[model samples]
Target: MEKLKPKLFSVMKNYSKEQFLKDVIAGVIVAIIALPLSIALAIASGVNPERGLYTAIIAGFIISFFGGSRVQIGGPTAAFVIIIYGIVAEFGIDGLIIATIMAGIMMVLLGLFRLGSLIKYIPYTITTGFTAGIAVGIFTGQIKDFMGIEMGAMPAEFVGKISAYSAHISSFNMTTLLIGILALTIMILWPKVNKTIPGSLIAIIATTLIVKFAALNVNTIGSMYGTLSAQFPTFAFPKTNFQMISKLIAPAFTIAILASIESLLSCVVSDGMIGSKHRSNIELVAQGLGNIFSGLFGGIPATGAIARTAANVKNGGRTPIAGMVHALTLLLILLLCMPLAALIPMPALAAILIVVAYNMSGWRECLSLVKKSPKSDLIVFFTTFLMTVFFDLVIAIEAGMVLAALLFMKRMAEVTNVEGWKYIDEDEEDSNDSDSISLKKVPKNTLVYEINGPMFFGAADKFMEIVSDISKDVVIIRMRSVPAMDVSALHSLWNVLRICQKHHIVLIFAHVNEHPMAMLQRSKFDVEVGLENFCPTIDAALERAATIKPYKK
Candidate 1:
């Protein structure tokens, strides 16, 4: 109960005016960085540009105020690019909004249940695989926009989209292409000049000016989507059905998982920067509130942004004031500069997303993993990447997880094998040798058994194969190397013990390890094996075997 206590709403002690000013400066700079990104990400997610600003305003403010981490800036991100597009394309924007709301509720529930710490149980290989897949999806989706390719009407499916792109190669607009290239190059080079102002913003300004001044034929936002409206955001409830629910469950789950991973990661990063640990559950709840408000205000789904958090830390923004100020900055921009946004070029926005996909892909790390990691990891990694390219993200993640789990099982099985006693190394120093029993002229109706290895279901069947020839009145089962048993194996042991009792065979569990013994005690394996027949070593089992011998009636 104490561990689950909330802290996100609490105020910081020793808050200073100087730090507040720094936070404001940092917030404004981040708003600049976020400005272009929010639009690009929203466009990628299949929504209008204004939705992104709404997310930066609503989710941003909520996350800053109720969030446990001081520096985290929450908004739509690359992680949601593929998932949101798929949802909006298949089920439309209304269905997407409903799903986002569902996902928000789930995140809040996850935190309230104090499952925040358990998100780490998701394996790194699995996360890496899906993340790489999402990056590929985002990259592929943007090619049409960046290259100014026209397909009249593009298909949503991956293969169809590619085929359409290929067929329409003749429709590429050189003017748009030039603008996109200019935007991309300028964005890549801008940070070297000044970190205070974002590269994407500079790129947007440059490309917009060139296209406008030169009177180029390229499509500006005005020509493509019409003039921007200065109006604030509005909310609407979605009409849902069973089919929509079934279709959206996968995307909602994906969003929840990515949100969980990215949020915790941002919290950890902030903790390292500020030297203050965060309450994870409280942070998650705040995330849920942020997402809820974002979806309501016509924004895409959001989570903690890592780069923005780092920026907040570096600019001397040590408290949530920085994050809140960032929200206010975006709001001010939305209200004042909404009309001027029409001058922005569509290809330039696409260029920003291209850069986003590149950064998210983590190509250098991906290549390094293939070079240095085990062959199995590379297989899972590439398999996920191709799956995203060819199919959908849900299938990619599901298949990658199955592959990783199979490889893990095979590794464990390799470490857990059985060997005949004669094959044991002569000079080997195993503690099990201290319990070996030597019995000469054994009784005809008696059996001596030795068992080794883990008692999991995978290894449980081997015992049956070993004891297939047994037809004895009394049998001693040696568990010299058995260390653990899952519930399935425990039940199997219980059933076997009952069968032995039915056959009038006195059974002994010999040389049991401490851990397995505790499990047995908890599961009441003692009642089935019998108190008298249980032993810590084979020597004790050998002596106990004497009293169990029976004469023919």
Candidate 2:
């Protein structure tokens, strides 16, 4: 419950006028940076330009107001572009809104249950694979706009989209192509000249003015989507049926998972940059609330944008106020200048998204992983990457997790071993005292075996085989090195105890750790084995075994 506290409250306790001024300046700067990006991302997601602005204004404000990280700036990021586009294509706007709302509910439940940290368990290889796959998807999707190819609605799948672009290759507009290339060039070069103003905004303003004044025959947002409207979004519930809800469940889950991952990752990055810790659960709840509102307001899904967050931090924003100010700034633009945004050239937006795709791809990380990671990890990476590109994100994530889990279990099983303990010479034992646990001479008629690593279902069979084959008056199981035991392993141990009872062989557990001990107690195995038979160390177990009356046939 403590994790539910918003970071804004803490920052406001000592808020100063100087800090407020700094936050305002940083917020305004981030808003300027976000303006063009919002429009580009909206258009990229197969929605009108103003929906992006609405998301920035509505979702951004909610997240900043209730978020866990002080410096996080929330909005529609490049990561959501592919998934959002697919949802819209398959289910239409109403279905997309329904899925988003359902996803928001899932996110809220995850946060309330304190399951935010669980998202960290999503494998790095899977994230890398999907991220790279998404980058390629985004870049591929923009090919039509970037090349000024006149095509109708593009296909949702990567292959179909590519084929369509190829078929329409001859329809490429040179004017549109030149404008896109120039915009890309300006974005690349603008940082060298100035760092304060965003290059994308400059590109948009410049390209829009050129096309408008020159009367260049090129497609703009207005030409494609119609005149921009300044109407504020009204609360509207999506009309849905049971069939639609059932169909949307998978995609909604995907959205929730991705949103949780991206938002938490941003929080972690912001924490590192600011020397602060963020409550992951609170951040998740904030993201969930943001999405709920965003859907109600006819906007796409939103999450903390890492690039915008970094910009806020770099510009001296040390509190949530900066994020709030940024949202307000976007709102101002939406209310006053949204019509002007319609005049922006589509090619420039395409160029901006292309750069975004490149950055989000994380190709360097992918290359590094392929070069140095284990073969099993590489397999997971490629499987996820290819699946995401050719199939669907939901399938890719499911398959990747299953494969990763199986491989992890195989590795664990391979590492788990049961071996007989042997005596070491005194001089050798002394030299290796810290590294190895030395054993004294075993008591007569006693068989001792040591179990190493976790005793999970995968390793249970081997444990049972070794113990069941022991033919001795007394059996001592050493478990000092066993870190944990699962139910399957416990059942296996129970079988061993039953076998010992049937054979009239005394069984003793030596140096069992807390987890195994608790399990044994809860299962009443300790009582069945006789509490005295469980010893604190191997030596004590040996002594107990020696004192046991000889088993008679």
Candidate 3:
């Protein structure tokens, strides 16, 4: 389909040798930066380290090869850590794969239906709330490794996790704590030292060497999860039934929604940086294919990683070739150096996730919203945040959306108003000298009621109450300001038309906007009220009213 055309094709048409070289260099640098992040995210997601690498190599390649954005690098990101962990914890790795595949299918359908732009309708407050909540969860989950606390399996719930950590406070390993703090310190300070090199990678290398040479008793990846697979990922299908499918549908939708939002948001950010527009539907399709392949290859869900995409852009990666090269570089590392990943210290990985949690929290934005946004918006924000922290993300999003819809309806109702035009005597005003003035006097036995704002269901009741109170031989409804109307509003108008007809009164409409006019015509309200009753202006309606004979009592 034309909608599925990848940006890579257009970029390659004008590709240059200099740009190619720059892309190659940037891609390699991004791959290096992504290496430690992928492994760390996988561990945080409660999966084997190799799964993350497989996602980077497989999904990363597929996305870049077919994605709409020029320099968006796709891979495992911090956003999915909470959802993936929950899936894996409840249903095991197989459930996670199946859910990811289902989410991929959903995404494909969304793209095919051209619903990419609709993702923007999701409220900013909800995203901010859930994102901050997830950050808190990730940070809390890392406490065990960060402090080297000796504890059994941590509880999945937020409060339970905190209680578990507190119970194990006496078992903290000072050596592990020192390593974590040191890794976190390096990450914070490394940007100032060299902007090009990633501090996470540096921390991994430095800490791993220190533990290996000194023979420290600290836990490493190998000690915890065993050595990672060096071979390429193989296709593996998951077994499922109707019951499992039904149970996974909600989580799958959650994943699909989240992937759509994150990838599109990344594309928007990339567009601003490169001064280019990205095809959102095409990107959604690419993300779907990427996740599908990633799941098939025993990997986790993947999307456009914002930080990595920014890295590509900042390093002069202006084409999809850079993203492709990034995937290839990661693939090479997976095939050649995956075994060495086992030597990476757990605390170092934990520290990296802590930094990730901190950056992803968006605390400044959250605080700003709390202080400046409207009370209704703050209610949605806090409700989503608390629900996400206490319950599941699915519940949090569902509740947030419902609350937002209700608040939106209330606000719309406040904006929509209906009032009858008051008769002003021509003699009371300093006489109008304008000969071009239309409708010199109000027509006798005629009432003009002005309807303002959109006539949706929320304001339909008020509209009906106002119009029902008008008693005249002819009623002219002025709707120039009404841009649109829903079915409820149309039904209310139909009721008014019937009441007017019952009383032998003529009903007319004046200056209706395009959308409302179309709706009225579609519903055949114009025919029921007589086509002649629809006027182009208030003056025209007044002229029509004067022609109509008075009703006989």
What TM-score, computed on C-alpha atoms, does each candidate reach? 0.89, 0.97, 0.96
Residue 425 lDDT (model 3): 63
Task: Give the per-residue lDDT digits (tens) of candidate 3, residues 1-553.
Answer: 3466899998899899999999999999999999999999999999999999889988899899999999999999888888888999999999999999999999988888889989999999999999998898899889999889999987778899889987889999999999999999999999999999999999999999999999998999999987678998889999988888899999889889898999999999999999998989989999999999999999999999999999999999999999999999998998888889899899999999999999999999998999999999999999999998888788989999999999999999899998776566655554453411232455768877888899999988887754565467988888988988999999999888888878888888888899998898898888998999999988888889899888667
**Candidate closer to the true structure by lDDT (higher is better), 1 or 2:** 2
For model 3, the run of ten residues with the poorest summed lDDT: 430-439
RMSD (Cα, Å) for all candidates, in order, is 3.5, 1.6, 2.3
Model 2: pairs clashing at backbone N, Cα or C within 3 Å: none
Best by TM-score: 2
lDDT of each: 0.78, 0.90, 0.90
Over 285-381, each residue of candidate 2 has an lDDT whose tens digit, in order, gives 9999999999999998999999999999999999999999999999888888888887999999999999999999999999999899999999999
Question: Residue 482 in model 2: shift from native, Å?
Answer: 1.3
Tens-digit lDDT track of model 1 for 1-553: 4244334345456767888899899888888888888878887788787888888889998988888787888888888888788888888888888788878888999988988988886666667767777877787787777888876755666788788888988999988898999999998898889887778999999998998899987776677667676667887766888888887888787787788889889889889988988888888888988888888877778899998888888888877888889999989999999877778888899898888888887877877787899988888888877887677777877788788878776665556554323223345545554544432323456677666667776555555543444466667776767777667667767777777766666777677788778888998888767888888766677677766658453
Scored by lDDT, the top model is: 2
